[model samples]
Target: MKGDPSPKTETHKITGLILAGGQSRRMGQDKAGLIYRSRSLLDRATDLLRHLPVGDIVVLGREDTKYGVRDTEPHLGPARAIRNWLRRQDKPMNLLVIPVDMPELGREQLYELLAHEKGAYFHDLYLPFYVRAAKASAVHASTERMRDLISAFDLTELPVPVHWRTALMNINTPDDLRALEERQLG
Candidate 1:
């Protein structure tokens, strides 16, 4: 169920929510603030989301962006972040959720996911998902595993483009980032 893509529409009021609230245990610092190719991951993620057709965009950490929502409940992870935002919404919200550390996720890559009305998943990499507001309550009720949330909805796994495969990985450590750099260089 985690890697599955369910049926649903992709139109209207889609909020591009950059999930930048993680504790960055692997990176030894705030990965969101880390610079990748001269731009901070936070800036990079927000810029990528801006190119999408989403109605609004918000960063879950760091106020450097135009619209930033400080994590009111830190250390709790993505579910807490979603729950916190859900309480502030007037109705069910459609979210194109991305992580700050994913430097390889570009506009084109996101469009692939958006192409599916039911939403998309990365198979093994369950993040950068299309989260429907209707399933938020169910996710909260279920396991905290981010995978479980996608499982509740029918999500289709977009075939990873050969060129974008390595880059799509969530850069969790400096080594991971360096490996990406090496791949690019070599």
Candidate 2:
């Protein structure tokens, strides 16, 4: 039996999670609704997920029942929003989490994360995480900070290539958005 062929591994269902439930205090508005490249950030995020092989896509923050699910408790943070969403899932699945503010993130970066069998994220970046739904309780038990939640799980820290550094930039303020726009134009 040493050379026996092994059974095929079952692929876990993947759910694309867009974390849009931020108060946007720094930008003084809802970051999800901000217009970038003539489309709302939320729309861009959804489109990115749609291009992937995910089974379902969920938006956490807005109240549009069609594709959005409001966080169990609003304005808490990304960690709490993710925890709430994971707890409500009917079954365990793989979650590809992204933030609405990361406009520069492309399919290539996401695909890179998907390449890892165990969950993986950029070395220093906390968002754009690929995690398992079965770890919901672990997330819930962690502190509200995203870094704390990341430490609760065994996730690989992928090295970011030089070309992908811009993709990790998060637009947290009007200045950041303006700088991104300038870079795009120039």
Best by TM-score: 2
- RMSD vs true structure, all candidates: 4.4, 5.1
Mark the regions of model 1 whose C-alpha exceeds 4 Å error after superposition. Answer: 1-12, 63-65, 132-135
* Candidate 2 clashes between residue pairs 3 or more apart in a chain or in different chains: none
lDDT of 2 by residue, 132-151 (tens): 54456666555688887777
Report every candidate's CA lDDT: 0.74, 0.80
Query: How many residue pairs collide in each prediction?
Result: 6, 0
Give Cα distance to truth, residue 61, candidate 2, Å. Answer: 1.2
Top candidate when judged by lDDT against the true structure: 2
